[model samples]
Target: MKYSREELEEAKRQIDSTLHKLRETIKTFEAKEEKARYKSQITLAKRRVKAFEIANYFIEEAMEK
Candidate 1:
């Protein structure tokens, strides 16, 4: 599938927003002592970070094309 520059830019923006939200959630979970909650938040944060990294890689690839 082919993506326009605008579409790629929008995807990058959404990923960035998701990353920011995950970071905030992690910070909030850090203040609590619920092990399950903390663990879940950390897992989500890691996933979000990974997603953002992947999105960035795609953006770079798109730019190079």
Candidate 2:
């Protein structure tokens, strides 16, 4: 499928928003005893961070192309 520049820009905004939410979630879960309860949340945040990184990579690649 082909994407317009505007579409990619919107996708990038969504990825950034999701990453921001994940970061906030991680902060909310930051407590010594709640670590166990928040393990999954932390993992999700990690994955989101990775996805953010990958999204940025694609954005750069496409811009370069």
Candidate 3:
């Protein structure tokens, strides 16, 4: 699917926001006293963070081209 420059820019902004929130969530989960209880949730958030980072990289590349 071909995305326009404006659309790609908006998507990048949204992904950036989501990535920041996900990182904060991971930090919060790790800081909890019973960190083991949220282990699965933390892992899920970490995976999402990685995915978003990859997506952002693609978006930037698209914009460059």
Clashes of each: 0, 0, 0
User: When superposed on Cα atoms, how far off is each prediction in RMSD?
Assistant: 2.0, 1.8, 0.5
Candidate 2 accuracy as lDDT? 0.80
Per residue, candidate 2 scores C-alpha lDDT tens digits across 1-65 of 76778888888888888888877888878755768887887887888889897987797677566
The candidate with the higher lDDT, 2 or 3, is 3
**RMSD of candidate 1 to the true fold?**
2.0
Question: Model 3: how far is 15 from its true place, Å?
Answer: 0.2
Span of ten consecutive residues with least summed lDDT in model 3: 49-58
Q: Residue 49 in candidate 3 has what lDDT?
A: 94
- Which ranges in model 3 have alpha carbons more than 4 Å from their true place? none
Q: What is the lDDT of residue 62 in candidate 3?
A: 96
- Where in model 2 is the C-alpha error above 4 Å? none
TM-score of 3: 0.97
Better of 2 and 3 by TM-score: 3
Q: In candidate 2, what residue range of length 10 has the lowest lDDT sum?
A: 25-34
TM, every model:
0.74, 0.77, 0.97
lDDT of each model, Cα atoms only? 0.81, 0.80, 0.97
In model 3, the Cα lDDT at residue 14 comes to 98
Indicate which candidate wins on lDDT.
Answer: 3
